[model samples]
Target: MGSDSHHQDGVGVPDELDRLWTPHRMAYISGANKPADGTPGECPFCRVPGLDDEEGLVVHRGEVSFVVLNLYPYSPGHLMVCPYRHVADYTELTEEELLEVARFTQRAMAVVRSVSGAHGFNIGMNQGAIAGAGIAAHLHQHVVPRWAGDQNFMPIIGRTKTLPQLMDETRRLLAKAWG
Candidate 1:
């Protein structure tokens, strides 16, 4: 066969595209669960507070803000600190809410390090949809744990992330460590 020759396998016809099946991302991509009108009644962040810890994947809850595991995690211990209010902009936060969110972010970092032995972290918030906020209606600070060589070829080349642990288990560990 020549170098450019193609052969058909039993599975199906070969194509130029490389597909990685990640059905879980459809909801996010399709915006199926995004808030209908960017209000507290429709915002998932607002609704999350009402659910229990396991159900919500909540690591810690403070007076004004709370920490929850990211459903679409960048890493095993990725988390988000969000205020209970349905405000979208950072400047919308009250003094108490701002302080609590900052405090929760710090606690989340400490708890994740203690639980997962993370070497470092990426902490920030995406301001708007243009800024890459999946849910631009709500303000959330992302805390993504980083290891020495955690950035592997899978995510870069194959567009896949290998999470070593499940969200519930990670949440349990961090919650325990936080308290």
Candidate 2:
């Protein structure tokens, strides 16, 4: 690479580093859609249950907890098991809520495996903002389906993830399989 190759265009400066721009992720990083206050009315988890399954991208609706597709998924079939109530911490869940969330998480894993033939899974919760919880206001457990080579050059080398499936499509497959 020559020095002239680093010229700044209207968009940005050309550099040696390869660029894969994902403007959509800015909303997540900037917390544009995050609730202003950590309240039920402003929380997406609390609001998702009221919407129809298709609109909400919900895979399974349990009595106390529900399974919904991750809008910005780590993988194609990434799902979150969440309680209907707007609780910030896992310890805040009632016995019924806790049991249902656990059940939903198990079912989510099975459904993802059956639908996508996932080789493995990465499942857990980021308890607070400091712990990397995108929506720290609501307690939810992530169930990310993983294949043999899912962690390829894109995420590792380029700091990007290539998601082959769309949200609605993944939701449909998982929801159908969950039934």
Candidate 3:
């Protein structure tokens, strides 16, 4: 009776069980759920010299703006375009800085699409933390590369997203484009 019951719905059960038991995934979940200390100070991303070669991230930097790979990315080529100035909102930025940001964002989108073969992109800014801004103190624009079948059952069903490439590799590609 038990064997028959197990065999009755065996197709997706194995895959589901395997995903649920992944040790690395478990660790990631634990780490994500841990409470943050919420310390406030200088913006880590603003410190440029220390950032180079840190991870598979940080593609390039310019006079007014810089590009960084999203550490917790929604897609493979996810990136953020941030101004050098530490401003909380877009309104706080100088017109020159805003113009630079727009130019850099367009350049970044082209680079990401050309390098990653992304069919489309989602680019925008969240005004505040309450509006889903991860770093509310620093104004930045997100440039997320998208593909036809980018959305999958993993994120919807398993609450996990799979990235196809490393951030370092993406950075290399973007750096070449920036040059």
Candidate 4:
């Protein structure tokens, strides 16, 4: 799946997944591209509250901030804390909004730790699309749970990263933590 090859969907194959299967490579490559809408369209975190599932992947939701599991995560228990209002940069957030974001971020880390038995976490924001933000229109803080020996040869050698647990299980654990 080198860049020279054309994917079935007609996009250029990413070089990183040259030896990987189509479906797996596709998922990784897709993250590199921007969404067609050019905007988040609707805030996913904000919409979760009105949805049927109260104990959804969304462990917490506040007036101006919320936390949800990352669908495509670096780790199984990965989550993100995002502001309800759409903003591309942290500078756009008001004092109250920033406060909420920080509060949710801390809460998300606590939940991730409790659920995943993680020793530490990588928690930060990618400011723009160029800075590796998958959703450029909305600034969000990622909370990636980490273990002592979690880093392995997969990502470095095989260009693939494996998660130890399922999203559903992670969601269940975090939901309990929220409660």
Q: Please tell me which predicted candidate would have the highest TM-score against the true structure.
A: 2
Candidate 2 regions off by >4 Å?
A: 1-23, 152-160
Write one digit per residue (lDDT tens) for candidate 3, span 1-179.
Answer: 56677768784355432232334345444555222432234564455425554452678777787888776677777888888777778999998888888998899888887887888899999997699776677787999988775655565665655676656777787888878
Model 4 RMSD in Å is 6.9
Rank list by TM-score? 2, 1, 3, 4
Segments in model 4 whose C-alpha atoms lie over 4 Å from true places: 1-25, 31-34, 40-56, 152-161
TM-score, candidate 3, is 0.73
lDDT of 2 by residue, 1-179 (tens): 56555563424463344455556667777887688878888898888899999999999898899999987777789899999888899999999999999889888889999999999999999999899988899999999988876666555666555677778989999999998
Q: In order, what lDDT does every prediction score?
A: 0.86, 0.86, 0.72, 0.73
For model 1, residues 81-146, the per-residue Cα lDDT tens digits are: 999988999999999999999988888889899998999999999999899999999999999999
Ordered by lDDT, highest first, the candidates read: 1, 2, 4, 3
Model 3 — which ten-residue stretch has the worst lDDT?
32-41
Candidate 1, residue 72: lDDT: 76
Which scores better on lDDT, 3 or 4? 4
- TM-scores of all candidate predictions against the true structure: 0.84, 0.85, 0.73, 0.73
Q: Where does the lowest 10-residue lDDT sum fall in candidate 4? A: 17-26
User: What overall lDDT, based on C-alpha atoms, would model 1 receive against the true structure?
Assistant: 0.86
Highest lDDT model number: 1
Q: Higher lDDT: candidate 1 or 3?
A: 1
